[model samples]
Target chain A: MKKLINGADTVLEESLDGFAAAHADILLLGAERKFVRRRTLKPGKVGLLSGGGSGHEPLHAGFVGRGMLDAACPGQVFTSPTPDQIIEAAEAVDTGAGVLFIVKNYEGDVMNFTMAAEMTGREVASVVTNDDVAVERSTYTTGRRGVAGTLIVEKMVGAAAEIGMPLAALKALGDEINRRTRSMGVALLPCTVPAAGRPNFTLADDEMEMGVGIHGEPGRRRVRLASADAIAEELVGAILKDLAPEPGSEVLLLVNGFGATPLIELYLMVNSAKRILEGAGITAARFLTGSYVTSLDMAGVSITVSVLDGQAKELWDAPVHTAALRWGT
Target chain B: MKKLINGADTVLEESLDGFAAAHADILLLGAERKFVRRRTLKPGKVGLLSGGGSGHEPLHAGFVGRGMLDAACPGQVFTSPTPDQIIEAAEAVDTGAGVLFIVKNYEGDVMNFTMAAEMTGREVASVVTNDDVAVERSTYTTGRRGVAGTLIVEKMVGAAAEIGMPLAALKALGDEINRRTRSMGVALLPCTVPAAGRPNFTLADDEMEMGVGIHGEPGRRRVRLASADAIAEELVGAILKDLAPEPGSEVLLLVNGFGATPLIELYLMVNSAKRILEGAGITAARFLTGSYVTSLDMAGVSITVSVLDGQAKELWDAPVHTAALRWGT
Candidate 1:
């Protein structure tokens, strides 16, 4: 594999080490180096923690800062962080206000975070985000998999936590956000697993895998590659079909790139998505476009739409300062 | 080529349209759609403008907002924007305080920006960043190519401009920044131009290109690929060799990924880079790591080190809000 790594076994540890060093002013490495906590924490404020596999960067760790996650536990590539790592992170960040766990709905992640919350012995509340409308079941997930909408949950709940919201209320707000958001993805190329030393799956040059999971898992279908406009339509169509948002409802549109997809293409996809939304009479109240979540070296795009209520919109618009996503500071 | 674009001819315009739409809060589409301007330009403030090809997303355009470029002109992929587009952007953003043009060192960019400044009929000054310390001469460039170091130039100069610095002073500051910064890049995979409909160049499965230009141009050498630590040593070695900062000097390190390189790899590379810097006894005052500058879908990494003074460091930390780079605001 033409990967920029020292060794497959050392990728996660080295990456986490680099991340902590790069953002020294904003992030601190936890006891085992498997978790990262924000450098500064407000006393007695609710702590927000989130994490998953290693490849989808700028997710849990990148989002660790003032108005986002307080700490994050990154597992090995495409693997869940162990309960011990999560529990350690929870204990480190927990203040008098308690801690909240934001989790993606992968079977391993769900189980691990749940175990960590129980083992921490802190007043911990949890929310499992399962907004991917791609498939009922996938390789690593049971129901729908959590996808890009996790970003929305992190942002909204992070803002609430920043304002000292209680753990129970934060959990409810996160659940509501997860319920209102939906996502769908399409992969133009397969990603190679560093350890496996080959692509996760074989795809013909002219074909694409639609609704692919972040782990390079099988999707709902594979079809001949089409124009970006068509791909946007298919992904957005799938998400909207599952969402059925009211005609004039305001929604936040997130056009995320699976790793290896260029920003130019993401913008083009956004253009196509905006065209479709305009035609459907839905207003995109805001848009976030970039590689917020990604599979390792996968060339694809995921479309996420969060049907927004006034409170959610306010929370989304609130100031956030993180290593990956920052604004309104 | 597996590119997510509608058509080669429409890539620039469509991407610009999407960028403007997605960042409508902070960006406004120029009259010709070849440029983007900040929606909230301070009257009488010094206007900052930069532009180049469309493939480098979030470069010129994504940096348009408060405390950064007042406007950006985008040309076709890997092609410099015409004098007409540059002139239009300068004229649109020019305030009574005058306008400053930041151009890369490419021949096309220099000639075109110079022509635009002459034709704009506004008080204009320019800075051509040529910080790549790779090959002295290469395709599309003369002395050197402006790589990721251009970001440091833009950030420092943008902050100066925000404080209402005059055109001459801003140009001098930019020139100093260019002189103090150095960059070098390596490519593991080549990028495909949408127009060409194929990879710009091919690499053997076991080979890599060092000092590759953003446009997939020939570099200093091609050799067997090595570990991330060795690669980082070579790149950081090249840059530090050109820019021999004293051991106690503070510097800002930027580990930029060419398009398609995952954040995971970039972070790993950053880890390697920090190790090298530490070995050299050089203090990395701060860091900016991401795909700040890209080469379409090319998978590679570039290391940029800016020898920092107190003033430059302060400018780097100033509040500036833009689509691609935002902080402190």
Candidate 2:
């Protein structure tokens, strides 16, 4: 596999250094290494924290800014952040209002974030996002792993905290948002980790994987590559069926691309989704089509939908500032 | 050439549908075909509008939340949004406070945004972010095209706008930020555009391209693979020499990965950047290491540095909310 750096070992640290130099507005703190909120916390506003592995760029860290997260702990490539690191981050960003940990539904993430929250002496509330609809829950594991839905939960909960909403209310709001969201993804190609210097999984020239995870984990199944529209139909169908948005109710659509999928493909997929939704008599009120959340170098796409109510819509409309998401002046 | 979609023709539309369904809190404004600020417009706050082609995720659109952009027009993959689309977005989001266009320094983007601004027939302030150090400036073009530095400019300017800063001041601030910022990137493998279904360029197994653009464009040169330390040193050397942040001056660092780079590799590069900066006596007050701005599936990294003074630092610290970035309460 081809890569740009001199060696694989030093990629993450060097990238962090570059990120710091480029956006001096944010602070990097903790020996364990965390992206801490730059603002001096107001005494009573709750602090929000989230994190995961490093390869999913802008997810945990990029989301650290106004109206979102206070801090984000990053782990090694495709590996969950250590409990010690999350604990350090939690302590550093926490103020009197407490901290909310937005944990994705992955086993490693859930476990690590849970451990860190438990270890924190201060009051902390946690919300787990399990919006991916591709996987079915078995007795052995949680239903579906969180994909892009974590972003909505983080934003909604962060906005509540920003306005001084109490911890219980914020948690409740997050849970509601989580309950209203669903996602499903398909992968075109397996990404090669720099350390491994090879594709994670081999694919025949015309093959693709459906319901793939962000870290090259196996998804529902492998299948022949299809047209963008058909793949989108499959993914969107799964998400819509899982979400089952109330008829005529507004919804938020997110057509995300895995790392390698081109924008052309992503746009085509978005077009397909519009047709599919319209055919079902579902009205999409807002659309965010891009690679918001991504798997490293995985050529694929994911569809996410959230049923919106007045409160949820208002929270979603709230102003936010972070490395990754910024809007609404 | 492997991809997950069923067909190329319907990616964008399908993706949009999913995005709208997933993010109902943000209004899609289907008839308008633009993402409007979900919040009721402040009576006299200037609307910030930005947009470009589809591939650059979390960019023009993701930044359209709170405290950043009011609206964004998304075009086809890697292509500039049409002038009509941008004009429509500008008109829809305008609340009598005028609109500002924060445009990256690409030829197509500059032309399209410029046309849109001109057609608005309203008082519109515009700032072009041109901070990539890889290309040199001449009378012929605006020098290096804007890369990741666009994100910083957007955040700072967005924060200013959120606080009701006048359009003139916001434009000045954006221009000043652009002046102090610089970026340079190298690529390991050329990314494949979905429609093309092939890599943009051919690379020998051991070769790398330097100074790559986000659209899979050719870079300054192609060279043999080097060590992470060497690559960091070279990229930093170019950027530092170009911007030359003075000794003891505070700076922001961003070691961004073009999609496909692993975190471990980024971390190693970050360490190398620190060493280089320390040797130069430059203080890195804040650091971000991740893939903030990304080319589709290119395997490479870019380094960015913003020289910061007290005011820039404060503005940077301000809270923001959007799809890609969120922080301070």
Among all candidates shown, the one with the greatest DockQ: 1
lDDT of 2 by residue, B220-316 (tens): 7889878777887888898889888878888877777776565445655777777888888887776666566776667788888889899888877
Question: Which 10-residue span in candidate 2 chain A carries the lowest summed lDDT?
Answer: A18-27
lDDT of 1 by residue, A63-142 (tens): 99988899999998888999999988888898788988999999999999988888888899999999989899999888
Instruction: Mark the regions of model 2 whose C-alpha exceeds 4 Å error after superposition.
Output: A1-28, A34-49, A64-66, A70-75, A80-101, A108-126, A137-142, A162-172, A262-268, A287-292, A327-329, B3-183, B213-220, B242-278, B281-296, B304-329
* DockQ by candidate, in order: 0.84, 0.29
When only the first chain is scored, the TM-scores of the models are: 0.98, 0.95
CAPRI rating of model 1: high
True-structure Cα RMSD, model 1: 1.1
Backbone clash count, each prediction separately: 0, 111
Error of 2 at A123 (Å): 5.5
> What's every prediction's RMSD, in angstroms?
1.1, 6.1
Q: Give the runs in model 1 whose Cα sits over 4 Å from its true position.
A: none
Q: What local lDDT score does residue A311 receive in model 1, on the 0 to 100 scale?
A: 91
